[model samples]
Every structure is written in C-alpha cells, then in structure tokens.
Target: MSKNIIITGTSRGIGFELVQLFAKADYNVLALSRNSKPIEALELKNVIALSFDLSKKDDYKKVESFIGSNWKQVDVLIHNAGTLLNKPFVETSMEDFEHVYKTNVFGVTELTRIAIPFMQRTSHVVTISSMGGVQGSMKFPGLAAYSSSKGAVITLTELLAEEYKETGPSFNVLALGAVQTEMLEEAFPGYQAPTTALEMAQYIFDFSLNGNKYYNGKILQVSSSTP
Candidate 1:
C-alpha cells in the first residue's frame, strides 16, 4: 500500500507544491489548510483536501478526528504551515507575536503531539524551518517575531528527536533557504527569491522517501548552493 501523508499549509507555495508532488507519487495525501479550494492542476485520486485553521487551539482535535476516521497509521506527517511578520520588535504588537507563535510554534507542536499516537516506528515527521532559525541576521532588522518563532520550532524538533530515541518515530527538520514562494514575496516584496517552490518540494519528497536510517533526527537544509 502507498504511504499515507499529512501536510499542513497546502493552500499555496511550498506546502502546495508538496501536496502535488506527494499525491503524484501515489501517496495518500491529506492536505490541510484554512482554505479548502481544490488545486485544479493538482487533481489526484489519493489526495484529500481538509480545511482547518492552524492557529486555532481546537484544530488539533480535528486532525485527530480525521486520522481516526480515515487511516490507522500516518506514514508521514509534514508540519509546513508558517507565517512571516516582517516588523521590528518594538513596532510589532502583542497580537502579532501571539498570532505568529500560535501558528508556527504552538499549533505545530500540538498537531505533532496528537499525531504521535498514530505514527509507527518507521514513520517520519518533517518540520519546515528556515535559515533564520539557525543564525541571527541583524541585517534583516524587522523579522524578530518570525525568526524567533522558527528558532523555537527548530529547538522543539531537536528536543523531540532526542526524547524519542527509542520507540519514537523518525523526526527531521528541513531548513529551507530563500524559497521562491508567496511567503518570501510577502517577506521581501519585489526581491528575487533564489529557490523555486516546485524544486524544493521535489527535493523534500525525495528526502522523505529515501528510507535511510541515518536521516533520522537530521536537520537537512535545502538551498540553491546545496548539492
């Protein structure tokens, strides 16, 4: 049987590309996003579009429900939903910070928490991170909220990786660099992005399907220069 996969933020960009690529590979894809509109170009037999707001605390329960009602085991879980708030810390309001954390950190963590029960030993969990998560760039003065949330995401991935050394499933984070997506456009309008969404999605699909034991707990960075 084909592997079952769940991917969040499938409305557009990298997440959207991931949904298309996985479905094309015959994987049972549960594409989750706030918008439920189907991608006409990506119509596939094994793909299901689920509408849910990741920022809402109750959405995790919906995820669990969908899993229970559909599949017994989720072969892969991809936490790819994220947002970018490009503003200085002082100018960023409390609401903006909370919203960013709610979607990137809290929502992702809670979804993973609920997903663990359905994951098998051979299952894989992939979280999409950013280069900003690994390094602090003062040159990009207005991204504190977004960058800090991603940093927390990477730390969470590491903590989970170490904690699940025995019976836990494989966990990995992909630190995608400068992906050419709507998110990047929103972050830096009129600036050219180096990476394409479709290419990055294909790379991520290949990485997840490699079935290598050594890949577990690895932080794989995908960039224009990465070979």
Candidate 2:
C-alpha cells in the first residue's frame, strides 16, 4: 500500500517541494496551506490540496474532516508551517512572541495531538525546525522570539518522542540551516540563502522513508555540505 503523508504549508517552498516529491514516489499526499488552490503544474494523482490556517485552533477540525473524508491512517505528518519575526529583543513585543509561539509551538503541538490517534504504529512526525532552535546563529540578528519559539518546538519533539516511546509514533525535528524560502527572505532581505527548498525537501523525504529508528527523538541538521 502507498504511504499516506500529510504536509503543512504546502502553498510554496519546502512544503510544496515535499508534496511533489512524495506524490512522485507514489505516496498519497494531503497538502495543507492557507492557499488551498490546486497547483496546475503539480498535476499528480493521489494528491489533495487542503486549505487551513495552522496558526488557528479550529484548523485541527478541518484536518480531521479531511482525513475522515479520505484516508484512514496517516503514515507521516510533516509540520512545516512556521512564522519568523526579526527585530531587536528590546523591540520585540509580547504580541509578536505570542504569535510566533502560537504557530511554531502551540499550533504544531495541537496538530500532532489530533493526528496521533489517526496515525498508524511506527508512523513518523517530522517537524521542520531551524538551527535557530538550537542557538542564535550569527547570520541573523534580533530573532530571539523566533529562535525561542523554535527552541520550544525542539523540546516538544523530544518529549513527544519519549511519551510515545512505548507504543506511539516516532517523532523527529529537522534543524534546517539557511533554506532558501520565503521565510528566509522575510527574515533576511537581500541576503543569499545557502540551501534550496528542493534539496531540503528531498533530504527530508529520504530521511522519513529510510526507516532509521535511531533518528527518532533526534534533531537532524540539513545543510548543503552535510548531506
């Protein structure tokens, strides 16, 4: 049977690339994003476009509805929808921090929670995090709120992995470094990004299907130089 994968933020960038790759690999894909319009260029069978805001609480219900109307089990869930805020720590407002956390941390957490029961045993949950989650890299400045939010996501990934250690699905986070996406453009205007979305998507797809149990609960870093 073909694996069923659900990818968020599929309107563009890494998420869009992932949808294409997985669909090409003969996997059933449910692509979710605010822009639910179908991409005529990606005319692949076994692919469905879903519209929902990951930052909102009601979006989980929309996901549930989609799943209920389609597949029975989810083989993989990729949390790729995230927001980045760049400003001095002193200038960062509480609202900005809350907004970032809601999407990066709380939203992801809720989606994973709702997806657990629908996921099959040994299913994989891949969260697209960043090196910012680990440490504030020098390339970008005044991103404390975004970095801190991703840090929470990393912690959540570890805890979820441990919680499901006995019988639940596997959880992992990808700490991507400088991927060339809209988020990067928004974070650092005019700066050249080191990684491409297609490359990162391919790596993520390979990692998810490799069935390497050891990767669970670990943060895998993806850079152009390091495979």
Which candidate achieves the best lDDT against the true structure? Answer: 2
lDDT by residue for model 2 (14-75), tens = 99899999988899998888887754356779998877887777878988888877887888
Tell me the number of clashing residue pairs for each predicted model.
0, 0
Over the full model, what C-alpha lDDT does candidate 2 score relative to the true structure? 0.83
Clash number for candidate 1: 0
Q: Write the per-residue lDDT of candidate 1 for residues 1-227, one digit (tens) a residue.
A: 98999998899988899888887778998888888685434677888887878887677777899899999789888888898899877999999999999999998888888889998888888888887776542336688888888878888888888888788688888887887888888887877776788988888787776633677777776665421
CA lDDT of every candidate: 0.82, 0.83
Cα deviation of 211 in candidate 1 (Å)? 6.1
Q: For model 1, what is the C-alpha lDDT against the true structure?
A: 0.82
